[model samples]
Target chain A: MSLSPLGASRSLAAVFLPIKSGGLVDEVCRRIELAVETGLLTSGQRLPNEIELAGALGVSAVTTREALSQLRGQGLIRTVRGRSGGSFIADDALPSPERARARLLDLTRLQISDLGLHWRAIAATCAGVAARRSDAADIASLRGYIRPAAGDGQGATALAWRLSASEFMLEVAAVARSARLAREILRLQADMGTLTLLPFGDPAFCEHIAELSEAVTAAIESHDSGAAEARTRELIQTTTNWLLAEHAAGQAHTPGTTEEEAS
Target chain B: MNGNDAAPATAELRTLVEGIEGRIDDWAAATTRWLNDAGKLSGSAIDKFVRPTVSDMLLAPGSNVTGAGFIASAGLLGPDRSYIAWWQGEDLERVDALANFSPQSMSRYVGAEWFKVPVATRRPHVTGPYIDLLCTDEYVLTFTHPVFRGDAVAGIVGLDVTAQTLERRALPLLRRIGPRAALVSAGGRTIVCAAPDVDAGDVIGPAEGAAATPIGRSFTLLAAAAVA
Candidate 1:
């Protein structure tokens, strides 16, 4: 996902910062705490130090400090106590089907539709632009990200596919030459978080993800913007349709099960 | 005001960019001239063109050209579809980007903006101050012009010049504009900037402000204050 040699994450940091004014500290604390719950801050990832956080979030340093302490109290972030010490997400804050289902169940149909529109727009635009802007190295690097989770029968292949598919999504955005688009996709990925990845648990869905991965890379390599874009949208639409089906059958059956795929 | 100071530098960069454009268009025109009478095109047909020209373009005194050659249109080479006759590197080695060249593989070059834009416009086009990743392995500005067979485009003739070369050659001229001065693409992606926080390739937004002056068809010299 490296786009610029300098810093690509500044825009990512901007996405989490509250754009409107209100009860600033509570809002800052709530947004980040929700980000953690939704798996945006994965296990072991460190939150930026308070001052850095304050600047990026555009909140007061005191506000950032207070928020960090609140998160620590909630067992969301555990701070280390050494030279390298900073707030880190607790190891137990792993993404789970429970969290993903709960989050997905919380979202209304209109909300999911809104998210899909935004996701498809950014994803498709990235592919189209990447097709035009990519060079041989971009093509080579993108090709490397297309490997699907091995059929190891080890039972964690769902998470494995999720990790690789998510990385491929981000990589395509970075290659697009639009940092703005990359940052937006990163934001959407964060907002959708674990719920967006639930479909990867299904072997059929993972196959589709892998196919789209290969197709989009080929289209970009071939410099076919139209095909690259259409394949990207197809990738999202496949996932969206799966999620909508789950939304329709809420709590009726276990997710991450073949039944979800069957529905 | 600093506006007056930036004026001369803007004109200088315009000259520099235009010079690069002129060289690329000349190469493209030379290619079209050869194809007009060559009868049929093939790998050897293109090699003869390169053996006579690539060295002069890449190693000539003060030359910035790093890669130059023909990118053929799809299906122009029998089952081979399209192929690149591009030569690059310090020694000017010949490199062909196609591997399988299957109907599937041919899709790769046909859509490259370097080839696509000129075909669409029927005029010379400049693409990227982007990382080349393919040739020269540096930030590159690719200038491409179409080669025609009858009324249809048969191929493109492209020239690659590293952004570093342009920056190294343009920085002194750019500094006269002011500390925040930058050379940006037509789309406002910075090719070079004096601001410490802004690196090349970050879009500074559309260069329509009073601070911007057109450099070439593809670039602008802007005294932007904010680093986007």
Candidate 2:
């Protein structure tokens, strides 16, 4: 929905860039589906019209229509008729394990490492800033997200946990009091998608990450910027390391694998 | 030093403030009339009354308002709790924030500066260039005006214009004042600046060569022309 008022929509522009060459219909489907799964297109958010979507993706309206049909079939989106009606993202359009795994494997080892380095740098800075600046009330907001209200078993799902983590990190960025910083985190969160939080779905890793988050929160509460930065770095680094290990193991199984081949 | 050189920037700043204040005035007046006539109403009723205006404000061509709505005061709505009817603007559609209206979300904004300043002072106020964690999640400048029923202050009517929007509007005028001028809040938060070393939302230390020109009641134009 381009929620960040600091023009984070500019980052979203990357999602709709004209396709150079590919299966037009599949590429369109993948782009929109990826945007939805990543929280770039939020729940109940309206999609751009077929003609607009086609123009943006540099595809024919028919291809866009076919892609929309595919998305509907997958339950990723639902289209409504009549005035004030359009295609909307469904409530449970969360990333699947198989999709997330394939996406992780699609990246080379170096690309994964580079993304981690970039994301961690911004996240660490955001943590320090949030530590120094967030007030009691701001902390009240953070408390809502640090641990998902796992009541009713709904929050036990991977989608809920990933969303909670995303909200927590985004809230931290907001509390840091910089729209620019918050916008960058939102963009990176989309870039990493649920892949970063794939580990959060596991009970053991979830607990470990929650413990690290507690340290991060405590540091922010105590206004310890250094510890906040360290904890934030460690939190993301732990996730990156796990993914790297998985990527290496997957590579070992398929010799001479490339991203295209893996996908 | 000359009237001609100083006139344009000062005039432009006034225009920008008026453009925002004009919207705040209409919102405040509308809410006051509603509260006075209908008495303190439920959050939903208030939302119903304000929704049309908010949509018009957000969707209007060239509008800078990212969100705008009314927030009722504590206890006036039965329990010792307040509720917000804030609507946040996005590209295609508006986001109805604080959708749950659970007491937790409502309580978080009760202490916000935009609500507090207008309530305490019993006058119109401008707040932030700070993150609006309550609604839009943008670094926004909130324009708040008090809504009263008789002598009792019922609540606040507030609107947000993103700092990015403000920076776009103010940079050229600030440049006219001095290449290094900044619109700084009373609390020293930089709202917009023509300087590279500083940014919006930064709490800047007083630079040695800086001077101030009052921009209405809320902010000052800080010029650091002597340094560079």
How well is each residue in A1-263 modelled by candidate 1, as lDDT tens digits? 65884466877777799776547877777766655543345678777788757654556899888888877887878999899998887988666777788889878888998899889998999899888767676787677667643543235456566766776887787677655676677678777878866787787777777788899999999889999999999988988989989987984554665566678
lDDT, candidate 1, B47-134, per-residue tens? 6785567777877888878888777787566654676677775677655332212233345367567888888888888887764534
Which candidate number would show the highest DockQ if scored against the true structure? 2
The per-residue C-alpha lDDT of model 1 at residue B20 equals: 80
Please provide, for model 2 over B4-89, each residue's C-alpha lDDT reduced to its tens digit, 9 standing for 90 to 100: 66578878887887778877888788777878899547655776788788888888988888888777788777777675666767
A1-263, model 2: which lDDT tens digit per residue?
64786567777787898877647778778767666564456677777778756644446899989999998998999999999998888877756787788888889899999999998999999999888776676678787787777773344866667777877888788768877788888778778875875676687777777778778888988889999999999988988898899898887877665666768
Q: Which residue runs does candidate 2 get wrong by more than 4 Å?
A: A1-122, A125-168, A175-181, A184-231, A240-263, B1-3, B39-45, B59-62, B74-83, B88-92, B97-104, B107-113, B116-124, B150-152, B225-228
Steric clash pairs (candidate 2): none
